[model samples]
Target chain A: MFFFALIVKPLVLFILGLNKRGQNNLPVKGPAIIAANHNSHLDTLVLMSLFPIAKIHKIRPVAAADYFLRSGFMKWFSTYCIDIIPLDRKNRVNKKALFAECHKALDNGDILILFPEGSRGTPEQMSQLKKGVFHLVKDRDDTQVTPVVLRGLGRALPKGTALFVPFNCDVVIGQPVPAQEKADDFIKLLASRYDNLFQYCVTHQEPEQ
Target chain B: MFNIPQNSLYTMLLVLLFLCIGTITRLVLKAKFPQKDYTELRQRIQSWWWMVAILFFALVFSKTTAIILFALISYLALKEFLSIVPSRPADRRVIFWAYIIIPFQYYWAATSWYGMFIIFIPVYVFLFLPMRMVLVGETKGFIRSAGVLHWAIMLTVFCLSHIAYLLVLEDKNPQAGPIGLVLFLVIMTQLNDVSQYIWGKLFGKHKIIPKVSPNKTWEGFLGGLVTITILSGLVAPILTPLGFAYGLLAGLIISSSGFIGDVVISSVKRDLQIKDSGSLIPGHGGILDRMDSMMFTAPLFFHFLYYVKY
Candidate 1:
């Protein structure tokens, strides 16, 4: 495993030039919510490589249980390699535990990578964000919700697509939003932010800060 | 599979010894002084150690392989540079010329075509690129667009190829071939950067230019020179055919120039209102971050070798 990480990974990067952008927004310390719109499975790896191994160890990615946790190898790889948190989307009863786990991860000062879109959608349109993000922020006032927009992943490895189209991926990390408002108001605020984010992306733009 | 023979082990050991001197100096400086905020100088040092380690391998490889690797490095570094800087759609035609010139320049180096590689980009590509764009009959963004393309090609493609040019030596002394010259140039230039940064961090009492580069200090400048001189003295035999005093002089030239190079790029980023050139590398901020040292180091190092060794 160490050999794969230190040797194989860098070799691949050296060959491909592993072009990435907006990686500096990754916090060097403490807990934050990496809220991104989902596009493909490779999106997780793309985001993970944007930081060092030590920081990556502290990040817990929230993946849907019904899809990824079905197989034992998938479960082990996801859990061990990326610290994926399998949320059973089919069962509402399981959501309570999942939410608690996210909070627990945050409380431990670990980063929780969340897909607010809930599922993959058409590349032309982003998935309407589930209210889980709003609730998560509202519950933990201290936790920062960082908006991470990943482009070109759908092209790399699209959902329902078997072939991996080799392409450059860009990961943009926006400034963190402090949890200050109520759930409904926070949801509206976040939704509007998502709307602007998608607009910026579609326009192929950056915030001129 | 061009491998360096075991007889070259003594030379490799000398390179390692020089690396140790620089690394130890850095450690002492880091311990003596630490930054409260996340500054560019702090970040450069953090990644430079790893850069030195990679360079160790580059120096150890067989002469032919080392030349190819440096060419690839120049290519990758240039690719990262072009991606971030915005070029108008009109510049597309000229960019095609720019990409092809990358490999051609390296081919000149590989075949020991010294005269052509030196003049190819500045003389031929420089004239040809603008002429091609002018023929396209696009008046829109004529100056601003052409200027960006020119800057990218000059800095990324032209200046960087100087590292490859180091592979071709006028004197074919097998004792210290072109590979040794290349190694010497890289080590001396990089050592200057690492040492100056360490000195500045440890005893950087007064900011030289607060607005342009806040972390730079007079104390650091003097300290870095002493450190680099000592390093040049140690690593002279393995990487270069230079005597200790000559190596010290060469190291000083590379370090001072590299410092100026870093400041120039920093000013560009500030003007652009961006923290980094572009976040292409983790821990390391941008293409510019990795290339900041190289921009000045390459041209300066090449000429120093050209004058001394050639």
Candidate 2:
């Protein structure tokens, strides 16, 4: 925990040159969930880097079981260094069981990184959001679910691409929407927040002059 | 020059001192505000340890090693500054050229080509960057984009190159060599910032310029100036060729101009409506945020010593 949080994390983020905003909006302590728009594989790195160095270890990003857990070394790296919550992307996703794992994490008072859009894609393109995040926190009043939208990450490392574009990525944090009962409304509200956050990043681009 | 082993011992002692101060502060803060958060103070101390270690090792090695180390720092500073400024699609090629020229700029200093190193960026590259941009035919932001790119080159590469150039100076003082000049400039400039912050919080009544920088106060400015000037005079005898009087003058110059650089960067951030250039360091905003004062102080002190040495 000390080695990864202290040394390895800062070095990786330094090389990537990530530009993040609204980090203060992150709840200092979280029994909460972060629902972000995933772009490149770089999205997870950028998202975690924005966390306060001390509390960064508390974040357990939901990683695909097939990809991250394939090899022994990677399994060790992901589990120990990254501390990801291994959740497979497959048919049905076992809503009741999935809810249990995430609920346990939230119950233990940790932040879980969930890409409600379900998979990585280009920035600013909103995909249909899943209701896993909503279900995890629906009845839990003590938990907070914040919307985080990432821009420029797709250009940084696009889907189905191995090379980096060396772009400056921006992250915007949105206000936590009240968790409503219906999955349909919560997903709809999450999608709109992603759009608003993305719009804010684009419109606020600095002038060269 | 002082014996290399003795110098290393002294530097390690300085590092130990910094560690002590940081640990004591952390403990005191924790005791005083047990309920409040000390995340920032902890991160800051953590960063300071790495920074001191990096620099101590750099100085402990040969001159070539120090030059390479500073070039990397300049590269990081340039990358952070350029990333924040808006750019046109056409400016991409020119930006690449800017990165390419970083190694070139250091190469000149590494080989001690003073004549060309001083003017290449300001004269040749300055002209070349805009000409390259104009060739791209992006009329929307041709002039503005060219100006910003040119300024980034000057600030990040040209200004920082002076530290490398200090190493190239002819050996005239055995008591204090070029590396000492580099250390003195860095240490005094940094101490100026610390004292000002401390003094400002203690005795800052009248704001120097509320519009440009609200925290800068006459009390803080003068307090830092006088304290650092005296300290510079005290340290300069063993650190640089400049004796007490010149060192005092150099300290005054550093504190004042470094203030301008700090405020100017602040205004630029204010105009852009952004805070703290980037997040490279925890508790400290970014590379640019940390280097703002050093960027200004390096070149000024370099030239000041250059003229004095010649």
Candidate 2 segments exceeding 4 Å error: A1-12, A19-35, A38-146, A154-168, A171-184, A195-209, B1-12
TM-score of chain B of each: 0.80, 0.95
What's the CA error at residue A104 for candidate 2, in Å? Answer: 18
Error of 2 at A30 (Å): 15
What is the per-residue lDDT of model 1 for residues B1-310, given as tens digits with 9 covering 90 to 100?
A: 4354332445556656765675676667767776534355445555655665666566566545666676666666555555445444445456556767878888888788878988988888878888999997777777876777778677877777787776666534456566666666665666677788888988899877789888888888788878777777767655666678777877777777778878887887676655665455556776567677777878876787668766
TM-score of chain A of 1: 0.81
Each candidate's DockQ:
0.09, 0.20
Scored by CA lDDT, what does every candidate get? Answer: 0.67, 0.78
**What's the count of clashing pairs in each model shown?**
0, 1
Q: For candidate 2, what is the total of clashing residue pairs? A: 1
Q: Name the runs in model 1 displaced over 4 angstroms.
A: A1-147, A150-169, A173-188, A191-209, B1-8, B14-54, B135-138, B170-173, B229-238, B278-282
The DockQ of predicted model 1 stands at 0.09
Q: Residue-wise lDDT of candidate 2 within A90-198, one digit each (tens)?
A: 7355677656667788788889898988887444356778877877777789998889987656544557756453445567887788878898998888887777776
Error of 1 at B70 (Å): 1.9
